[model samples]
Target chain A: MAIAALAGFVGALTGLGGGIIITPALTLLFGVDIRYAIGATLVGVIATSSGAAAAYVREGYTNIRIGLFLEIATTLGAIEGAILATAVPTSALAVIFGTVLLYSAWQTARPGPVSAAAAAPDPLAARLRMNSTYPTPEGPRAYQVQGVGYGFGLMAGAGAISGLLGIGSGAFKVLAMDRAMKLPFKVSTTTSNFMIGVTAAASAGVYLNRGYIDPGLAMPVMLGVLAGSSLGARLLAAARTKVLRALFGLVLVFIAIQMIYSGLKGAL
Target chain B: MSRDGGARRWTDERIEKLVGNLLRAGVLISAAVVLVSGICYLWHAGTGAAEYHFFHGEPSPLNSVSGILASLRTLDCRASIQFGILLLMATPVARVAAAALGFYLQGDRTYVVVSLAVLAILALSLSGYWVR
Candidate 1:
């Protein structure tokens, strides 16, 4: 539970999912099965996403209209990925998890893309009314959405990763929204948080039906992450997130190595 | 977006506030249930981390929606905890349903259709479509 709390704090601080820490800690440090870890952490993902999103939604950072439009692809992909989780070998899942961890760490180290070219609007985006303004220091800044089709495709992949790995896919979703669709980083992150719960809930049902969700294990984890994340959000203004994010990125790398090594050893 | 041939009953702001309340309330209630059930469970089950590290699958009652409800009459701590988790899971599903309603009120036909499609997928998954 304490570890899960820490995971949530770091996740909120670093814009990473708590599952990245919880799953590795459960499987590597605690010797819990990866499958069970995934199941339990999926619950935490829902808790944190829903809990955090209320504030975001009310604050108007969440583009509910845009989010709903993309969710069709994500929900479809999530179901497929959840079903795949049942068939995939545990060692393979570990390998995939490690690879994703490395990718997330790399993504964390990278800067947000500057999409100066995104001013041009797509007919599809305009027709769908995805173009909107977010509040900035100056005023509500209008931004045109480009590449709706491409962003939707990436969102599908993000949902698959969310289901298969039990992470929030904050990195992947930002990649779709910020990089592909050219939403402001703030809007991307907040809207991603808003969308994550629905994506995870799509997988949650499958996880439950597969008998992977252990209440005894999930109870503490869910509560701990919820509390810790809320606390982290509160403390966010006081903390130096740049340094913390870098340190967390390094931690992700270390955990990734450990996961991959153990996975290879197990496979052999 | 209002093409519904009438004044919309709920403004987007009001609906957004409702959604925000729904999400927070769902999480809090579920967390309270989990916390109480967890304390009761830990008191009875003891803090045996060793056994819990293994992956022995749960029984049918703990694994299915109907089963979770049916077993609640017995007041098993695990079942209660599962029920809490079920509520947590339901929040987002309900949010999607609420979103559909919001868009319907706003008369955004495209978005209403989109929201319903996502909700249908969630409903399918909850119905054991993947598992069966």
Candidate 2:
């Protein structure tokens, strides 16, 4: 529980949900089964996402319209991924998870520009009213959304990865919104955070039905992540997140390598 | 300046606030339930006994709703934990439902349909309709 709490704090600070840390820790340090770890990590993901998003939504950084619209794709993809989870070999899942982790590491290492391009909005985005404003210290900042199709496709893929691995897949979501959709960085992050809980919940339902959600394992993880994220939100202003993020990114790379090695050896 | 437009904004804010608080409260209540149940579970089964290396298949007797409910009636710790997790899972579904209502009230047909589609997918997952 304490480790989960720490993982949640780091995840919240890093804007990656706790599952990334929790899954690797459970599998590596505690000798927990990958399937059980994924199940427990899903609960933790929901806890942190929902707990943190409550504030983000009220703060207006989260674009509710975009979140709801994108969820149409994410939830569907999550269901399909959950169905696949039951049949896919665990070793294969580990390899895929490791690849995602490495990609996330590269993403973190090279932060992309928050596209302020004055490009024309997609017809679908305009029809859906995907353009929105986010509150800033100065005032409300307006931004236009573009690439609706690409963003939706990316979100569906992110949701599939999330369902399979039990992480928020926030890196991909942020990439979709910030790069493809051309939303501001803050809006993209908060909106991604808001969307993750629902995305995870969709898959969690399937995991629950599959009996992957063991109460004995999930209870502590859920409670621990909730407490940790709440505390992390409080400490965020004081924490030097740049250094912490770099350190965490390194940790992710290391874990990714380990996961790949284990998967290759059929020992995951 | 129209009353309809003014009312629409009012309802939108109301729904957003309600949904935010609903998510907050759901997490808190479910976390509390999980905490207490965890404590009980830990007391019953010592912490050091979990063998993480082995794959112990599905957790039986608490896999289905009926099974969880039956166990919960007896105040079983594990069942309570599962129930709390269930409540946590329900939070987002409830949020989507509330958002759909919000869209309907705002007369936004596109979003209403979108939210309902998301909800339907979630419902399908929960219904175990896709189980093989």
Candidate 3:
């Protein structure tokens, strides 16, 4: 529970989910099965994502239209991925998890990403009426959405990762919306937060049904994450998070290496 | 971007606020249920060794809603925790369903369909009607 709270606090500050820390920690430190770790981490992921989204949505940073549209792809992919989770070899899953963790560390260690607003709206986006505005110091500023097809495809991939690994995959979601679809960074981040809950819910249902969700472990993690993320959000404005994010990234790198080593040696 | 941009923005804000409040309520209620039930669980089984190193899936009854509800009648704390988790899962489904209704009211037929499609997938998963 303490580890969960710490993971939740750091993950919220870094714009990730507790799963990245929770899963590896459970497997390596506590001797929990990888599948059970994933199931419980997923519960924490939903709590943090949905809890944070409540604040983000009210602040007008969320793009509900884009979020809902992308969820069609995400939900479909999540169910497929959840089904695959039960069938995939545990070693292979560990290796994949480690590799993804490496990628997440790289992403976090990098400098903050700039928004990729489009010069012109994609015709498909315009036709679908997916273009929208976000609030700014000046006023509500209009931004065009582009690469709808590519963004949708990436969102589906993000969902698959979320289900298979039981992580929020928020970084990938931001990559889809900000880098692919060219929404503003704040818009992408908050909108990704909004979509995370739905995407996780889709796979969580399958996990629950398949008996992957053990309530004894899941409930405490959920409560811990919810409490930690809420406090993290409150502290965000006052906290100098640069050093903290870099430190968190370094920790992920260490965890990733250990996970890969364990996977290769079949110690898991 | 369009002539009705201002009106659309207003509607979006209202809907966003409503969605925000709804999500907050869901999280709070879920947390409360989980907290209460988790305490009961620890009280009953705190001294037992945790059996999570192996990946045995849950029992047949605990995996389904009907079974969980039945367990709750006997004051089984584990089932109560599952019930809370069920509520947590349902929160997002409710959000999607509300969005579908909102879009329908807004007359954005395309997004309404889009939201419904997502909701359908959620429904299938919750019902355990999908491929095992």
TM-score of each: 0.90, 0.91, 0.89
* Candidate 2, CAPRI quality class derived from DockQ: medium
Rank order (by TM-score, best first): 2, 1, 3
Per-residue lDDT for A54 in model 2? Answer: 81
- lDDT (10s digit) by residue, model 3, range A49-78: 788788778878789988998998888888
- Model 1 interface CAPRI class: high
* lDDT by residue for model 2 (B1-132), tens: 464794567565577787889999998898888888888889998867776566665566677666777789898888899989888988888889989888887777888899999889888877676664
Best by TM-score: 2
Please provide, for model 1 over B32-100, each residue's C-alpha lDDT reduced to its tens digit, 9 standing for 90 to 100: 999999999999898666455667788988899999999999999999999999999999999989988
Residue B77 deviation, candidate 2, in Å? 1.1
Question: Local distance difference test, per candidate?
Answer: 0.81, 0.79, 0.81
Task: Pick out the ten consecutive residues of candidate 1 chain B with the lowest summed lDDT.
Answer: B1-10
lDDT tens digits, residues A151-251, model 1? Answer: 99999998887887777766677668876787766677668777888998999889999888999889989999998877765664445536755765686
- Candidate 3: give the clashing pairs: none
List the per-model TM-score of the A chain.
0.87, 0.89, 0.85
- Scored against the native two-chain complex, candidate 2 gets a DockQ of 0.74
Give Cα distance to truth, residue A176, candidate 2, Å: 1.5
